[model samples]
Target: MFCRILRRPGVLLNQASARSLNRAIFTRSYPFLHGGPSIDKKTAQKITVNWLYHDGKTRPVSAYVGQTLLQVAHAHKIELEGACEGVCACSTCHTIFTDPVYDSLPYPSEDEEDMLDLAYGLEPTSRLGCQVTLTEEMDGVEVRIPQATRNFYVDGHVPQPH
Candidate 1:
């Protein structure tokens, strides 16, 4: 099972390198004022997201405030098992917030709470990764994906043993 998951192409393309490229492009295109409080132009705030996978790999990704955690993971091509494509239906997107700062995010909706109940490895800090959006206050947030979700499931299609 682990081999099958790891076999996915381009799964481990150094996420930090990609993020740096993105940051460089962003900073060059839009340089914000270095000085304090009298802002005429919009300033971009950086939020650090640590995506922890079942294989003990922790990927740190940088995102702007107001971006969803799901969006950030997708951009970095991190192998988060989003079986429902972030639609809040499947528990495959379940994750636990390793960083306490995740508490700063707005409370999850009823649907999110319901879906989380179906997730494996439920814990006090468990949440649906897709449902968590990044806010300025949630800078430096860290989340972990449960091992159970690493495999993809296709209806009536069983994956062969590697």
Candidate 2:
């Protein structure tokens, strides 16, 4: 009966559901099925970020997939001055990537590039930390915060003390 059911068209069985069905059908039978490719176990990828502060302290952090670099920094209480609050209007959150993994990040938008132009100490790897999203491919990424951004302002107004 189980073989007949499995032989029918378009029958999909996930691991959990398959195990449940197997247990119900054959009470003392080992839950093992032949045929079909083995499922690959998923491995969580890690991203290593180094926050280089103006005071010469290097804080290392680990981030998982789908987290923005800014989010990671903020979670660790790292001082990355985002004067425009990550709206891409100010260059206060500017940072440079020291690792080759910088190239793995997506290209910046016109707005982010425009903001970076206003940032001091703009290097080839310069980017707005808020705009960089962490991916599995971005492992071991190193970023350095510039000293000039510690006191940045937006529209001539300073951000209030946090």
Candidate 3:
């Protein structure tokens, strides 16, 4: 009886279906939850970035090529918080691209779209810092960090770590 049940083909199909359902449910319920991007330090180089603070202050720093904006900000002691640790998960790292640089970067991903939708001050050229990688073309990028972030669920409760 045990062998027969183990060999049942429907069991495998049911398990696969359940896994797919779980993924869809989780993605929909928590849009700002995701894994980090693959990092290759070999591609690391130096670049320049200008950060505009919420209080009308701007600062320039040397950032590493291929490093996400969130990483550079954190390393330079900027006032930005990557609540999701550069995983493109939380909108806590939401930033606005200013002028010429905004038109140079690639478009945002679907997951980024979902998180940006929940950001406090969504703009036409807003992007998650974790999703934007530094490139040669983006040498002099200008990013603006908002004063506060809306780090809560739709129910007005902060998300708890699992």
lDDT of each: 0.61, 0.66, 0.71
Clash pairs detected, candidate 2: none
What does the lDDT read for residue 22 in candidate 1?
41
**Quick one: best lDDT, which candidate?**
3
Say which prediction, candidate 2 or candidate 3, comes out ahead on lDDT: 3
Number of backbone clashes in candidate 2? 0
Q: Rank the candidates by TM-score, best first.
A: 3, 2, 1
lDDT of 3 by residue, 22-121 (tens): 4334444332344344446566677799999888998999887777888788778776666656555568888998756777788887667776776888
Worst 10 residues of 2 by lDDT: 30-39
TM-score of each: 0.60, 0.61, 0.67
- Compared with the true structure, model 3 gives a TM-score of 0.67
Give Cα distance to truth, residue 110, candidate 2, Å: 0.6
In candidate 1, stretches whose alpha carbon ends up further than 4 angstroms from where it belongs are 1-44, 150-152, 155-162
* Candidate 3 RMSD computed on C-alpha atoms after optimal superposition onto the true structure: 10.0
State residue 14's C-alpha deviation in candidate 1, in Å.
Answer: 42
Query: Which ranges of candidate 2 are over 4 A from the true structure?
Result: 1-46, 150-162
